[model samples]
Target: MNAHNIDIALVGAGMGSESCLTKEVKNLIDNADIVFGAARLSNSFGDSDRQNVIDTYRVNDMIEKLEEADKDIKAVFIYSGDSGFYSGAEAAYLRVKEWAEEKKKENADLNVNIEIKAGISSVSYLASRIGISWQDAKLYSLHGREYKGRVPEVIESARYNEKTFVLLSGASDVIRLTDEILNIKNVILYLGYHLSYDDEEVMTITSDKKEEFLKGEIKEGLYTAFIQNVSPETKYLSYGIPTEEYIREENVPITKEEVREIVLSKLRLFRGCTFYDIGGGTGGVTVDVAKISPDIKVISIEKRPERTELIRKNIDKFGLRNVTPLTGNATETLALFDENNLVKNDNEYENYVREIIKNNPPDRVFIGGTEGQFRDIIRELKKFGRKIRVCMTAVTLETRNEILKLADEDTVDDLSVVEVNISKLVRLGKQHMMKAENGILVATFQL
Candidate 1:
């Protein structure tokens, strides 16, 4: 088990060229007995011998090679961009450190030293090239990962922050993101292609010209994007969105603004919690809750297909990607979501529901309309055996009585009720008058 002293250095190669390498990194590469990195990074250093330079970016493969190599050697692992910013350097460092720790435990005399060198990140390079500060920008990377939810997340980040920087994989990611960006207004996309290389190209396009830009050809390679939103929506800081702001059908029922504020307050939402808006009519409550945090997954279930379509439209209008609309009876949907009945079926929506529920069960549940199956829905939720906060709004006396009856149930706890009465100012012939809307009773409790 005895091993010789080992010096492991995880170095950042900066942008894609030799000129971007820090002087210290260059010295490490020059003096190291062996080097490990992608072919592009390892070959960039002309002085390093090809025999000593191992062309492999996989962390495990690098570790395996290091283990098989001779002891008492100075080994360097090169990573593209800054080692700390969404680069593989972090993983390589951790894995090597773990290996060194285990080896040292077996052999006390073995000297293992691991160090990480910070290189200029693409964000910093692009920002400097464009004459902008990156400290105020939000950074994200879609490289070597699933990007299904990331497009909306980056778009939402741009809407809230003045600048957003995203490290993309290739032309596919760029096209997908730009297609969504075209729907937004007042935001500009700055794309950096093959940054720091001889053929590096930087293109700036505003939201208006995104269509034409997408129509033309985009060379595929390493890419990074910077989004500048002139007007960030600061109003999302508060929960209550005016009902008039939503695109609503005259026949569909929408939750009142005042009532939604009370319901959201009672729900006490947190980041990354799964929320279910059962009986979502116009999706007013779903939209408000989803805005609270992009991490929150809001599932709006409506029985009527028309109402579900309206919810989708509202989600699009607000540029929100976290809300998923399910069209079916609320009680039936609850049954499908039950722990025992959840099976991956051919239905895409059902499978999606199962995945979300299985991974992140409902932390918060809001029932605006129960369709007279209120008790059945509560019973199904209780089967999950997790602490869930439930909020319900009742406009009719029967529905109010049904909610009140839940207080006596063994599954319910911390029950509280509040009646919200809203009145609007109206103009009569020569004077203003107060008009009263329907009274809503809001009930909140724990399950």
Candidate 2:
């Protein structure tokens, strides 16, 4: 053991099999003084002494072991799959690099070297085995993490992209996702089980066999999947989804496409923000905001049950996963969203409601139909005690005046208003005439 130097290698073991190991990674493992990985990865190399291999993939545990070493050491941390592709190798490398730098600063004579080796990712391996090019596929991972709207995001991705590749946790996840995929038309599901092992299996489920396949049992193991959308929808780069594209009823009012565009712009949405679409009539505004990003959590609150159902239909038509439609009065719903209200109920339904309210607080808000509860809703929003950007539309003078009155309140800032009037050309017996719609007042403020 030398006293002055330490060398570390962060290696990607590749697809849980010896055959998938890269030559460089194999060589590093062969000569490593100490190895760190999960038991499966460590067991793959039979020749390596068990005493020198730590059966743990956590970076902190590996670092602690290294710190206890009395002499200079060559340490290797093995991660499954490509180091760069959603593997623990990246985090291990970063943490080790930071640790080494700090150690060098404390001891002038110490020398530390760190290197990262990449390996075959499951995406590429599965794609190769099935004779498909993965360059066109959109990749997502659900391994060992909780992702909000996981199914919906995947479904939406499959709709827009020709192929959607997902790295899943286990058998249950595969079944759950497959069940959702079965609802989509003209899509093929390619399921890979225990990839790269001797018993590796891949099954292709088409629309024809989906019903039969869903009823059968699924083998439990690490899984990777691909959904091929035969007729992928065209991707739209900007927001304002046309009004005709939505499922609208004559009675339930929808924010017009023109007004939606202006209101969304005024709200100043950003990624991962929580948005409250209070009085989400037909969910037009809710869907538009949700389309901005899957990370953006849009909760659509509607007072009428029929309108809430209509909002849900529009959500389904658009294949949006990030919008949560709740049926209740806007102000009353806001009151129920409090954590105190959550503690009062212990039922499964209340638990589900608790998760949503506890996790997402409004970062931005859109008040579409207040039903004469405008001031009450504003008061509820103010209770959050955080800066919130608000945008609302008013077709009545009373609502417009209510918005203006906020300027006098100390809690509100940057209050501004704009009136939008739009006209469309309609065909009247071979002649086109401009038809005017009611003007809407768009108000924006910060709270």
Candidate 3:
């Protein structure tokens, strides 16, 4: 159990600098019989010949080489950045634990003696470089090799956290990520490229006219990152917030608060659900879904830019991060993720969203402003699965008939209908009177 007699040592290589390494970690590397890490990383120790330092870019290859060594050999694994972050230390530890557990059964005297040393992470380094505290930041990595498919989830994380710290892989990804983020107004970007090295540079840009500034600074194959500064929104976990909390304007409509509560309930959203708000005018229902959980991906689709602006304004006012406004017709925007149409294209945002659709798909879809394309939109959503949740609200008798026409025994499961009518208090001189609001019929299906 003694660290000094450790048979396996994992050391953190802070920003690939020998001077930044801890004295204890340096001593471990100097006294160890073998060292393992990526070629570029392990080469930092090339000046020292007292130990046999093995280098490989792949983690599996590193483990295989480590296992091939003598059973009693003292080895050290070096990972760049803080080993506590997404530095692949957990995976390596699990693999080593499995090896040690299996080895103990075969050999009577074999015990895995492992020790970990902390190092500076990119998040900490960037925070120091930008003079900002990362104590309130959410940590994420786009540099994962195995979990590469989940890279698009970075946008999802940025939606809820006031500060999001992302580890970049290359310029392509950084551009794609920042472009997707710029879709939402009020987000300020702080980028740190080649952090802690001689060519290191830190840049900041507010939302106003940032595309050209970003273009001039981006270069391929650089160690890059971006910190999103957002206003933190308090989640109203107690039922729902009052109607006046959201921004409202003329020509842009929103669902009534009472109907919105029942609509979200019918959606049956669980953890990590992708909720689509078609005809998402003013984002009233969007906020209702997002306030419940930060992990949900809520997309508000509207045709008019003015109404889209209302949604954005509402997003900023409520400090909601998970809700995004897409300014396109629902029929067209939803088609972009269609399985047949979404091959590969220049639109990185579309491609990124398509990947999420392929992996998670929409768990719940709300049709509030279908704009007479309700049948087409539902058909596209049906492509995801037959057993998905679809909730639609009709405010008029004519629109209610259209919703009923889309329902059938073959397409609907556990189908049900509910009507919500609300009356508000109004002041008339010295007395209060009840003013009736328009009623909405909520149609939901297990399909």
Candidate 4:
């Protein structure tokens, strides 16, 4: 759109100043009869005609002023970041449409044209500065909004796993989010403030100390928080471990690598899932569940007391929030989770899970190591109406027998058992393949 034909051009000022301004945006600012922008930002429009400029935060007021301006003169409204992405342009367009409609009702003849010009968004700039790409990162804007409940899932996901996150308007959310992060343990935090400015500041911290800093106990400047997993040097030092971590040492722990593949595949977890790895042997399966898909919260139930304690210790080390460790028989705890106790629903066992996913619905459901009581758990899972894909692993003959029984049952929508075995390449004078002593039977149900 040509500025001369445009009644007003809403331009972006990039993130900071004139130096970051695009040449086209600079020209528009220079030639306009009047400029509309934020007070702090209007000063950046060097060489602009000051007498005709208007500086205010309210777009409605600006629209009114623009409507009253001389018809032949050009007016430019400047905004920070891209006009198309969470900028004021959408609000301005709606307001202008409303004004035009009201004028038509009054039978007044007025032509106030409008157009938008895009600019580089702060997300792109900030990500570029950190040598990260926006293609995979989850983007969130906290400006003028509260993120108390809506933020926990994403924050926990970013904190627990290897992923990237971009945030705007983070000045207020850092504290509450940090609290949520602490509950998970061992999260890494990076804060960037006044980016691309001469007074720009950045700080990195752990979830344990995020609250102290956000509370102003630690002096810092305005910034955005980037929460990520701890690197290799500290990987074993994470605050929370998946309940699955406990099982490995008990001589019954699911291998971390094996569990990771199974849980990720069964859950198909993209966002959130409340998974219960019943009969969790030490918690290895649960840890892999939480670690591989940070979004899937795992609640593992083991009957042994020592195993329960081990799960807690591991959770503290890995910093996983998406896991809830329960010590007791799987059947009893599953019974206590009445639908009434859930976010919603009643009469179904999965409602406890359903209520979680209803309030926080899971993308997948897993019942790893359902041996002797496989049929009973399968019956309970059926009550949730099949929104979840239930997966279970059987290793021993007794467990495999239970799985075979489950596979033959008609109560479930569909059931299949897969036998998996692996071998390692062994070499002495010659090379040979040695069967990895472990074998597993995986049962899956779809409803």
Best candidate (score: lDDT): 1
Query: After superposing candidate 2, which stretches have Cα over 4 Å from the reference?
Result: 46-51, 147-149, 337-342, 346-355, 407-411
> TM-score of model 2 relative to the true fold?
0.93
- For each candidate, give its TM-score against the true structure: 0.93, 0.93, 0.70, 0.60
Model 2, position 96, has a per-residue lDDT of: 90
Tens-digit lDDT track of model 3 for 342-371: 787898866765665565567788889776
**Model 3 lowest lDDT segment of ten:** 144-153
2 or 4, which is superior by TM-score? Answer: 2
Report clashes for each candidate as comma-separated counts: 0, 0, 2, 28
Which regions of candidate 1 deviate over 4 angstroms?
1-3, 46-51, 343-360
- lDDT string for model 4 (1-447, tens) is 222223677888877656788888888888887787887677667335454767775778776776554346777888887888668887887876677567555444455667788887777776667666666666666655556434645654565355445454554566666565545545566667776678776666675665567667533334555666554122343333443335246365554455447545754555555776776665666666666555556777777777777776666665565677666655545544445544534546444443443443333666665546666665555555547777776668887776677556666667766787766567757666674857877777775
lDDT for each candidate structure: 0.86, 0.84, 0.73, 0.63
Question: In order, what is each prediction's RMSD in angstroms?
Answer: 2.2, 2.3, 6.2, 7.8
Q: By descending TM-score, how would the candidates be arranged? A: 1, 2, 3, 4
Residue 43 deviation, candidate 1, in Å?
3.5
List the candidate 4 regions with Cα displacement exceeding 4 Å. Answer: 1-10, 16-78, 84-114, 120-165, 168-192, 195-221, 224-248, 255-275, 293-309, 315-321, 326-358, 370-373, 396-402, 421-439
